[model samples]
Target: MLTETGKEYLRYVTEAFDILLLGQQNSRHAAAAPRLMLYTLPSLATKWLLPELHNWRACTPDVDLALHGTHAQFDFNTMHADFVICFGEERYAQLEKKFLFHDEVLPVPSPELIACYQGRKLLSKAPLIHLEWVNERRFLPNWRDWFQAKEIEEPEPQPSFIFNLTLLALHAAVAGAGVILGQRNLIANELASGTLVIVDELSLPHSKPNFLAWPQRTLSQPGSRQPIAWPVELAGTDS
Candidate 1:
């Protein structure tokens, strides 16, 4: 019932539509992979997270992680950050938070240093290493805090080294520089390898917990929460 020209036109129209759909499908498949931008302190990334990244890779093989390290405050919108791992109480009322883990602050010294101070109180005998966080607003337990918790009069020992980052202080302690008020969670690997030892079993629970936070709107997306959950799981395994 149809003329040859009409049949040919119908066939061309169908082919054009099929080609458009195929193009769209190819565009989606060829699109750049999804990336999640995560920000945190340099020490935390290097000491606590870096060692565990292989596990993260096995879990999120398809998602690319962009890790940024800094102590400066960041705007989520301006930085295009998907999430931030922060220490202390929640600061952003608008952001959703997930508790990762709590760490205890304690004195850590190299085995060599401990041997040198055998039978003596290392806190009073050995050189003290200090770590002062750049962001003063978030309080991390220091030697003074530990002493106060133990009800011992705090000493005003002049530190041989003063560092503004945890990683630096940790490395110093490992090099037998001094006894550092180390966070257990951050030095688990070092302790396991007998690189550092806890001094006198003295430790104070950090008043705050480390947490992961992100914009509430991110939850509207399908896979947004996926990246957030793995960190929490990893922290649990570390515990």
Candidate 2:
């Protein structure tokens, strides 16, 4: 297995090759309409990206867009995306990165589920849908961490449902599977639409943040690729 340093060096090498070839790629695109390839976390793609796509299409009709989704690290060389939405503050030190946003973890359940629970204690005992971080990402925000943040003990396992993807955990909760300690930004539409409602008042902002990253060549030729313009006002509350 490779150390973290080894992984970063590999990313740098890939980016260097991409920059070296960007001019040739740009020239090819100059012959036709501009196009962009974007890779994003699965949850962000389903909850936010898909809902706001019409606006993205309307805003940049001159550009052709293709989207890809995953919860794992991406190889820019193979993905062929102009930019990627990755979870964490600094995925690539050599590549240019922008702070898009991060999630504020909060307990959300279907309105019907809310009806069965009275208070936080009862809610805690209810089925707790969990986003089980896989790979080396176990340190990412989770219910156990959030409980610690609140200065409370971890709840019993309760044979709770576990999912690798946050989006799936949230979907299960919305379908009344259980209460999910969901990211506010990712579930804002459901909260707004009254499909899912907050069960606990306490909110735990994710220790990690999300970011948008692009090659240096992308900034040099901004006209060739337009990154996703996430709405500032619609951004989820932090506290």
Candidate 3:
């Protein structure tokens, strides 16, 4: 219904509107506070980070943090995550990495179980509860490793129950299901509440250390790099 010139003019108008809409969308994003997405293991977020979120807020009040708890690796290109907390010294060719902490694991059992075993010399007979590492490739400390660290000669006891998550394993121990080689940092609440008590005086080092990694592109964004720096600054903090 239109001539060639009319068709050209119509196309120009359509392109202009498209460009305007895109600019508005971008402007909206720019006007909003800068938000950073952080991906880490499920248990770390709930057991370690959640309690200390108040400190994080106090430090970076302006920037928003989107904490995503996941066991699976995410693609930076697709996921748009600003940072990742890995279980080991994960070397990414394009990402900058820093060490957080290598926590220790100790045998923790419910107080009720301790009372049951009171005056007994060998606490090794108590049922062991195991936490299955989601990533089989990474070496995480287990009951066998703890026993070796403690120089125990007897055969490692089989786990009464195995849980896939640290929280579940901790809960199982709290419920008097069995003893678990709980990370010292993760079992703070249970220990404080007297629901769980450390079996031995010695603690075994965790096989792998936790690391914080971020893509190089993260540094390019203004006001984005500061929030992530807090982790390294507060490395030894339980929260």
Scored by TM-score, the top model is 1
How many pairs of residues collide in model 1? 0
Query: What's the distance in Å from true for residue 70, model 1?
Result: 1.2
What is the per-residue lDDT of model 1 for residues 121-164, given as tens digits with 9 covering 90 to 100?
Answer: 67777899877766562467777777888888876565568898
**Residue 59 of candidate 3: its Cα lDDT?**
83
Number of backbone collisions per candidate, in order? Answer: 0, 0, 0
State model 1's lDDT: 0.80
Q: How many Å off is the CA of 72 in candidate 1?
A: 1.2
Output the number of the lDDT-best candidate.
Answer: 1
After superposing candidate 2 on the true structure, give the runs of residues whose Cα lies further than 4 Å from its correct spot. 1-32, 152-154, 220-222, 228-239
Residues 1-239, candidate 2: write the lDDT tens digits: 87999999999999999997997787777655576777888778888788887877677776777788887777766656677777774556666676777768887889888778777755667788878777635545677777887788887778689888787788899899888888887887898999998766788766677777777666554444445354332343222
Model 3: lowest-lDDT 10 consecutive positions: 116-125
TM-score of each: 0.80, 0.76, 0.79
CA deviation > 4 Å runs, candidate 3 = 1-32, 91-93, 119-122, 155-159, 237-239
What candidate 1 gets wrong by more than 4 Å, as runs, is 1-32, 155-159, 220-222, 237-239
Deviation of model 1 at 139, angstroms: 1.8
Comparing candidate 1 with candidate 3, which one achieves the higher TM-score? 1
Ranking by lDDT: 1, 3, 2
